[model samples]
Target chain A: MRTLYHLALSPQSRLIRLVLGEKRMEVHLRAEPVWERRDEFLAINPAGEVPVLVEDDGSTIAGSQAIAEYLEECDDTIPLLPGTIADRAEIRRLVSWFDRKFDREVTDLLVGEKVMKRFLGIGEPSSSAIRAGHANLQIHLAYIAWLAERRTWLAGDKFSLADLAAAAHLSCVDYLGDVPWDHAPEAKEWYARVKSRPAFRSLLADAVPGLRPVGHYADLDF
Target chain B: MRTLYHLALSPQSRLIRLVLGEKRMEVHLRAEPVWERRDEFLAINPAGEVPVLVEDDGSTIAGSQAIAEYLEECDDTIPLLPGTIADRAEIRRLVSWFDRKFDREVTDLLVGEKVMKRFLGIGEPSSSAIRAGHANLQIHLAYIAWLAERRTWLAGDKFSLADLAAAAHLSCVDYLGDVPWDHAPEAKEWYARVKSRPAFRSLLADAVPGLRPVGHYADLDF
Candidate 1:
């Protein structure tokens, strides 16, 4: 069996988990507190990040994008990336948008300050940072709405890693009950379709011991 | 001819430039002030970032990783990524290491505070941020030395995009003369090898009008 070392609220980890499920690959999940700088985890991934996947053959794959591409190479069953070079580029561009742009502008500010800080004992959450996160979230949601209104999925007609990546980040923030779903109904509708997928079940069931997700987080109609 | 929208100091842009050069692809470089959020540039990449590549057919690829993968898919002549699935994973993992981890901890701090701030006219650079960038850089250099000491190349036997990504970030910072080369001899040796490649010529020759690079910036012997 393969194993995934991950953090519950981590968007990166969430993204990988979603990818694995989409690929229909079963993986034993272990919650790793990376901030502790565990030597074992560090040995697995020198970068000390979560969502490091170790195969039954003892081969290890680190980094979400690396793992995502590796899975695509290993199996083409559910094809998260669309065909054609141009379409693939668009999918990857959106993936980077969510992974890098959204992560920096939104997720880090919100989750880094609100959730991870407490877990790592890194002091109180900054109100200003949270405020900025919400502001950025609005802009990103609008962007998502813009895409959803036009394309069937975030990337195109096909359900791709672009949708997975965007949903993964949104899921983490939504868990904190921070997403302005009402303000961006089109984006909300798009997310609802994604959330109904079989891959998202495990994520909806995810619970962080002391911290609770939003009330409507698991609700399909929310 | 292909076109690359980039900023000379951007690590992501530098990575793409190196990859393009390594693949023997000719590109006309256009310096883009991304912070200005030029509508024309925004149309190319909504993320408002640089290193967006436009093909002769007008097909566009945004994001460094996307562009790199696109290049690999399009042409395998130089084959910056290795042969096997495992090898490719390792290369990409290291590429992510440099692009995300190294950039966040080092490049963004140093370059963001120094060069980008100047270009954006966003006030003075913070001394503390620069101090932290240098501090984080030492650890990264030591890690590079560790890898170089053990492997024939950063990701394994063949020179891959892993090396290009790492070297790209280092080169950008090195331009500002912030790299402490004396502390990591093995890393410097590896960089020297990368620096001597013909593909690196364009990057080495890069010069920003008002802010000049260090005297040894383009010198392969240094």
Candidate 2:
């Protein structure tokens, strides 16, 4: 069996898990405390980050995008990046948007401050960052709504890594009850569709000890 | 001809330029002041970052990795991401190392502070950040030396995108005379080899107005 070193709340980790689930690949999950910077984990991934995938054959692939691309190449049965070269580029663009931009503006502010800090003992969450996160979330949600209104999926007519990357980040924020779904109805509708996917089941079920998810986090009707 | 909207000092933009140069692709370069947040630029890439590529057909691709991957897919003549899927994964891992981790730890602190802040008029640079960048650069340089000493190139036997991405970031810092090349002779040797390549010529010639590069920045034999 393949193994994945991940954190419960890590949007990158959740993105991979969703991708694996979508591809129907089975993987044993091991929560990695990246802050501790364990020697073995560092040996596998010198960056000390999550979403490192180790094949049963002992080959290791670190970094979420690397793992996602490797998986897409190795298994084309359920192509997450399905399209022409240009279309695939669009999907990747959105993937980078969510993974990098959205993460920096929203997830890092909310999840990083509110949750990860508590676990890592990095000091109390900053009210200013939380306020900024809320402000930024509205912008991102509006963008999502814009995309959702304009296309069948986030990238185009088909589901791709873009949707997964976005939903992954949004899901993490949703877990913390940071998302104001009512403000962006179109984005909420699109997310509800993504949330109802079978691949998203495990994520909604995720419980980071001592931090209970919001009441509607696991609700399909949400 | 394809056009690349970029900032001369941006590591991401430089990486793409190097890749394009390596592939023998000609592109009309347009320096975009991203801080100005031009509305037309935002229409193409809502994220509003540079290194956005527009094909002759008017189709566009944003983000460095997206453009790099798209170019790789469209043209296989001189493959930057060469070898097996696992091999490519390793290359991407290193690309992420420099593009994300190293950028955060070193390039962003050095070039971002010493140069970008001056251009953007974002107040004075922090001495503490410059100090931290120098400290982190040693660790990254040592890591580069470790990898260079073992492999023929940063990723493996072949010159790959990993080398380009790392060199792109280092070159920007090198332009500002922030890289402590003396501390890591092995990494310096590797960088010297990359610097001598014809693909690196344009980057060496890049001159940002109002600020001159270090004297050794354009020196192939440095």
Candidate 3:
């Protein structure tokens, strides 16, 4: 069996888990304390980040985006990218938007301050950082609402990696109950559809030590 | 000709430019002041970042990684990525290394502080940030040297996107005269080879209006 080294609350790791689940691929998951910079783990990925996937063939794939693209190529039963080049570009664009932009503006601010700090014993969370994270969340939620109102999915008609990427970040934040879902009903409607998917089940079941998920985290109807 | 919306000093934009040059693709370059949040630009890329390519066929590709992947798929003549899946994963991982990790730890600190802050009129550059960037650069340079000593190219035998991505970021910092080449002689040698490529000519000749390249910026034998 393949093995995945990951942090439970990492959005990047969550994105891969969702992709793997959507494809019905099975892998043994190992929790990696990336902060410790373990020499053995560093041998696999010099960046010292999760999630890293080790194939049965002995090949290792590091980084979420790299793993996602690799999986899409290896398996075609469930395509995460669009068929056409133009449409695929749109999907990739949205994936970058959520993974990079949204993560920087919101997830890193909130999760970096709240969860990661605690895990690493990095001291108290900054009030300004949390406030900024919440403030940025509103803008992103509105953007999500805007996209949901126009397209069937975040990128287009197909539920591509863009949707998964966006949801992955949101799921991490949602675990902390940071998302103001009610502030963007259209986005929430779209998310509800995504949440109802079987791939999301594992993520919803994720419970970090000393950090409890929100009440509606696993609620399908929420 | 296709069009590329970019900033002259942006590493992400530079990576796309290098890829375009490698493919021998002609493109109209449009300098975008993303700080202004231009309405027209935002329509093309909600992320409002550079290196957005608009095709002659009216298809638009945003984000450097997305654009690079799209270009590779669309044009295979000068393949910047290796053929095998595992090889490709290694290439992608290194690309992510330079683009995400290096950019965050080094380029962003230097370029973001010195150039972008001035462009956006975001106040004076922090001395501490510049010191931090220089400190990080030494670590990355050593890593680059380590890889160069082992492989023909950063990824493997083939000169892949990994090389281009690393060069793109280093070029920006080099332009700022921040890279201490003597510290990592092997890495410097590798960079010289990447710089000598015909595709690197445009980047070598790049001169921002108020910001000039370093003395050896366009030097092939540097």
Candidate 4:
């Protein structure tokens, strides 16, 4: 059986899960404390990154983008990536843009300062970092809104990996009530569609021990 | 005729030049000051990054990996990337490993502190950043050395995109006298092979107007 070694609430992990769910692929989710670097998980992913997928054929895949591509290659039906070479490249670029750039600018600050501290058994969240993350997220969401406003999906009419990538980042923030949904109604509406998906249900149900979800986290209409 | 939109001093551009030259492909080098963001270049690559290839057929390719893949697709002779899907994935992963991570930890620091300072007309280097960068460089170079000590090439036997990515970052730092070639013997030897290539001659000739080459940069035998 295929198995995924993942951390709950990790955007990349969630993105992979969403893609797998969309594909209707059956894979056992083995929650891995990526930050803890357990020896077994480290053996699987030397980078100690989350969302390492182990294929039934026994080929281990690391990197969320790589895993997604590998899954697409393994199964042809219900493609999550955009169609056409150009379109694929566009979507990949957007996915990368969010995964790397936006994560650094927005999600990271929030997660590291707020979520990580709480997980590490540290005290209260840093107000300044929270404020900074909140501000940055608004800008990021506005950009997403602009992109969402123009295309039926992030790349085009087809729901591609870009949607999963964007949702992965957004959902993490939304769980903490960090997303200013009012800033981008279209983006929020898109998030609603994304969160309602069967794949996302698993993510919504995830509880990080002491990290309680914001009241709006489980609300489909919120 | 094939044309390369490149920053002359950029080793990534140099790597592309070498690949083009090795294939005996005649390419007109069109120096693109990426920082300037000219309208023409922006139309070619919205990201405004270097090594955008404008093929004779008027098709434009962006991203180093994308350009390389296109090149491999266009011409199968003198193959750069390794064969097999797994090998291709491994090569791409390594290419990204260096291109993104190492660039941030190593290249960006040296370039920003040294290269960008001169280009942007900023005076004096940030000693603290340089000290921090040097420490980071040692760690990165050690990993490269370890990898080089084991594999025939960065990714495998074939000179893949990983080599180009590594060379791109190293060459920039080498120009700035940041690379301690004397310390990392394995990486240094690998650099010798990369540098000795006839295709690398053009790269060695690159000279930024206000910045002169560090003492040993052009000494191929060094």
Best by DockQ: 2
Q: Model 2: per-residue lDDT, tens digit, A1-222?
A: 999999999999999999999999999999999989999999999999998999999999999999999999999899999989999999999999998899999999999999999878889999999999999999999999998999999999999999999999999999988899999999999999999999999998899999999999999897
Give the poorly placed runs of model 3, Cα more than 4 Å off.
none
Residues B13-80, model 1: lDDT tens digits: 99999998898989999999788899988998888888899999988999998999999889988899
Kindly report the docking quality category of candidate 3. high
In model 2, where do residues sit more than 4 Å from their true spots?
Answer: none
Per-residue lDDT of candidate 4, residues A130-202 (tens digit): 7888887887788788888998888789888888999988888888888878878999888888788887887
Q: How many steric clashes between backbone atoms does each model show?
A: 0, 0, 0, 0
Q: Judging by DockQ, tell me the better candidate of 2 and 3.
A: 2
Tell me how each candidate scores on DockQ against the true complex: 0.86, 0.91, 0.80, 0.31
lDDT for A98 in candidate 2 is: 92
TM-score ranking, high to low = 2, 1, 3, 4
Between prediction 1 and prediction 3, which has the larger lDDT? 1
Please give me the DockQ of candidate 4 compared with the native complex. Answer: 0.31
lDDT of 2 by residue, B119-221 (tens): 7889999999999999999999999999999999999999999999999999999999888899999999999999999999999999999889999999987
Residue pairs with clashing backbones, model 2: none
- Please state the interface RMSD for every predicted structure, separated by commas: 0.6, 0.4, 0.7, 2.8
TM-score of chain A of each: 0.99, 0.99, 0.98, 0.93
